[model samples]
Target: MTDSMLKIENLHAEVEGKEILKGIDLEIRPGEVHAIMGPNGSGKSTLSYVLSGREGYEITRGSVSFKGKDLLALEPEERAGEGLFLAFQYPVEIPGVPNTTFLREAVNAVREYRGEERYDALKFMKFVRAKLKELGMADEFLKRAVNVGFSGGEKKRNEVLQMACLDPSLAVLDETDSGLDIDALKAVAEGVNALRGPERSFLLITHYQRLLGYIVPDRVHVLSRGRIVETGGPELAEKLEAEGYAAYVGEPEAA
Candidate 1:
């Protein structure tokens, strides 16, 4: 069995026959938080989508082992069943679905997949309410449609709430800090920090080092084009912030 929570070996992927990820390699151990920072179109989101088994992003070479299983072989829902979570850069709004109802169904689906007993209505409300309290979200959020009419911060906070409730083994935040004000960023970061523990791992994907200032990753990687070119400690994020991705992505791409 593999000791790493997420292991990718020479992964290659393409979308609509155009290659995006090229010979990428990464291994995330349990309890570690890793950050991927790169310029736009660096395949950061592609990597996250591939891991989540999103459609159209095809993996043509290599393998991904998550918790000792071949992650690529699993369907998207199956990947979720195996305890993977992804927070998107642009959260989609469901116009008619109430947030509480959506969250309840999601929680129950995961519970069923994990062979655990589903939470009853009263139980679910209690559990979700507590999580909302912890994230400092208002109770009225439950009655509103998912992401509909929510501010950028509220959408991100809702995602944090989902992370708290689902409690996945690996959570991938894909440019979650984008479009957030400083206050919103810190609030979202706090929610993510609260979930950090020995069994949980996080893969934070962003374009800037601003988010790193709050969450403080164990490893920071610089991805250029479609591959990770550099890896270092938290200081790397600071360096990238100071100098920018010029060395890794070149002057034109960095600008």
Candidate 2:
């Protein structure tokens, strides 16, 4: 079996003729957490979208492997069924669908794909209840429409809830801390921490080091102008927090 949950080698991608990721290389092993920090348009979100198999982005070159499987060959739904999850920076609102129902269907779909037995109504509700409590969310949230009119913090919290329910092997959080208040930020962090285990890994993409203070990644990489310019430990986040991204904001490495 492969030791890494996700491996990206010389990944190059573009959208609308504009290159985004330029020869990026990264490896994520199980039980590890990595943070990618950079200024706006530094390919952090592009990496997340590319990993999740979102459309409209073209892969110019390189490879992405999840558990030794060719990630680029799989569809978006296939990626999810294979235990890859991406928490969007701006979660969308799905009106007319109750949050609980949406989550139950999503979970059951993944379970069915894995050839696992589907949950009954009571069993699913109980499972969701426990997960909600684990995420410090209220029962009332289940009754509301899926992210419809939800506050910024609420949407992020709900994203965590979904992640907890799914129990993915590799989770990519793109700007999850954006627009969250201090209290909500802690709640989101706590929820993420609860899901931390040896079988799981995370790639956290954020602009500020404050989220890193809560998540405390095992490593940090600075992405600049379409590639990772610097890779370091937690102290790199502190340095960026102190001095800002100016230190690493320059021309990307030659391809």
Candidate 3:
């Protein structure tokens, strides 16, 4: 088995005839958490969408491998089956679909893909309740429509809850800290920290260093003009927090 969880080589993508990602290269190993910090319109979200196989954006060039497989060839659902998860920056609401029901279906789908037996309702409830308790959430959350009528923090927390239930190997959190207050951010960070282990990895995309202060990524990459121009340890995040991305802007793309 390959030690690399995700590998991107010369990845170039465009949306609506405009190129966003240009010659990007990155590799993430198991048990590592890497953060991508970039200015607005720097293609951070685009990278996440492409990895998740979202529609519309075209992969003009390059290749992505996940677990030694051609990730770009797999359908979005197939990507999820491969233990890849993308936590949306803006989670959508689905009325009439109770969160519990949604989660149960999702978990069963992933389980079925892995050739594991599906969980019965009773077993699933017990399992999910434990996760909720771990995240300091209540039973009431399960009964509500997915993201419907949920506060900002509640929506983000609900995303974390899904992450826990899915138990993905590689989680791409795209701007999860956007619009969150300090307390909410802490709660989300704690939930993420709880899930970290030797078997899983994370790609946290953010604009500020405040989130890094809580999660403390193993490495930080600076995305500029849709390319990763610099990479360093957690200290790099602090430097960006202090000096900003101005220094890296307009620099030549990596060869």
lDDT of 3 by residue, 83-183 (tens): 99999999999999999999999999999998889999999999999999999999999999999999888899999999999989999999999999999
Per-residue lDDT value at 251 in model 1: 37
* TM-score pick, better of 1 and 3: 3
Q: Write the per-residue lDDT of candidate 1 for residues 49-123, one digit (tens) a residue.
A: 999998999889999999999999999888888999999888999999999999999999999999999999999
TM-scores for the candidates: 0.97, 0.98, 0.97
237, model 3: CA deviation in Å?
Answer: 0.5
Best by lDDT: 3
- Misplaced by over 4 Å in model 1 are 251-255
Q: What is candidate 2's lDDT per residue for 3-22, written digit by digit as tens?
A: 99999999999999999998
Considering lDDT, where higher is better, how would the candidates rank from best to worst?
3, 1, 2
Q: Spell out the clash pairs found in candidate 1.
A: none
- Name the better of 1 and 3 by lDDT: 3
Question: How far does residue 124 in candidate 1 sit from its true spot (Å)?
Answer: 0.6
- Per-candidate local distance difference test: 0.93, 0.93, 0.95
Better of 1 and 2 by TM-score: 2
Off by over 4 Å in 3: 250-255
- Give model 3's clash tally: 0
Candidate 3 has an lDDT of 0.95
